[model samples]
Target: MPLSEHEQRMLDQIEQALYAEDPKFANTVRQTNPAVHYKRSIVQASVGFVVGISLLMGGMILQQVIVGVIGFIVMLACLLWGLNAWRRVAVGGEAAAQSQTKGAEPKQRRRQQRPGMMNRFEERWRRRQEGDDR
Candidate 1:
């Protein structure tokens, strides 16, 4: 179902947050047009399997049952190729999860040291050293 406008805005916000969080993963997801990818894989696989069946039937008409059987096995294997193709392109969905990972983000600049406890400790130590110097 299509999302309502409100839901769509919400989704957009979430997507922006994700992109902000992890541009690399967002790029990966954008690389795949899933519908086109899946359909091409399925169609190619189906055509291969179908051609294999046609060859099998032609062999049977030639009274070459052994050849026909071999062709049929090949057709089965080609049909399985469809599933394999789908698997190969199926990782696009994981981009959402990747967006949650801080480390997955592409590098910009290195992070500046924050004014956390470590900074505070360093500041205190520096003050003591300066006092000793004086």
Candidate 2:
């Protein structure tokens, strides 16, 4: 729902107060975006993968099995992290695109197709509450 004019004014006042008290924080918060976080995560994971490769190579040269194992673990972790970040970015963009498209599916159907963890929990909680009410 759209905010009322009074609510908008109140929100504006709150925003102004925040900016005046800590402009740096307000600016940072405003600039921070989900896409930015995902991009950073993917970049960091790629860097970590390179470091893992170096570690593995160094371990092999030094004949240290432990270091090699550690490097392998690090590489696996980075690969998973990068893939997860990519998935999040893709899903978020896809959802927005889907929402904007003409002849979009009903919200109920779309939601049922992909019930997230929180959604499942909420459903369970609602059922329990209804049971208690009876």
Candidate 3:
């Protein structure tokens, strides 16, 4: 359900109060965009992957099985991390761009209508905990 104008105003007031109470935290949260962070992570992972490949080849030529295996593992990990970051960047960036073009009315409605995966998981966890307490 969309918030009524009165409720929206109240929520805005509460947000303003929160920012006033902790300007630093509010600034940090507002300033950081997850898509940008994900892109940076992808770059770092690419560099790590290249290093891992060099280490793996060097270790193999040097006849050190342990070193080679470790290098291979590191390379695999970096590749996986890079792929995950790329996925996040693509999804988040696209969603952000789409939202800007379409405007906030539909976006807010969609957000309000659907509970996120984390919210559902948290709800289940809370129920389990309550059951355990009893």
Q: State which candidate has the highest lDDT.
A: 2
Q: Give each model a TM-score.
A: 0.40, 0.58, 0.57
Q: Candidate 1: how many backbone clashes?
A: 0
Write one digit per residue (lDDT tens) for candidate 2, span 25-129: 999999988888999999999999999998898899999999998999999999999999998888686557566564455765787889989997888899898
Q: Where is model 1 more than 4 Å wrong at Cα?
A: 1-35, 86-92, 95-134
Tell me, by TM-score, which candidate is best. 2
Model 3 segments more than 4 A misplaced:
1-14, 93-134
Q: Model 1, residue 22: displacement in angstroms?
A: 24
Instruction: Tell me the deviation in Å of residue 122 in model 3.
Output: 47
Clashing pairs in 1: none
Better of 1 and 3 by TM-score: 3
Query: What clash count goes with each model?
Result: 0, 0, 0
The reply for model 2, stretches above 4 Å from the true place, is 1-13, 93-134
Model 2, TM vs. native: 0.58
| 1 versus 3: better lDDT goes to | 3
Error of 2 at 99 (Å): 5.0
> What's the CA error at residue 2 for candidate 2, in Å?
7.2
Q: Candidate 3 on 1-134: residue-level lDDT in tens?
A: 47999999999998899899999998898899888899899999999898889889989899998888888988999999999999878767766667667796888898889998999888889989889532
Clashes of 3: 0
lDDT of 2: 0.89
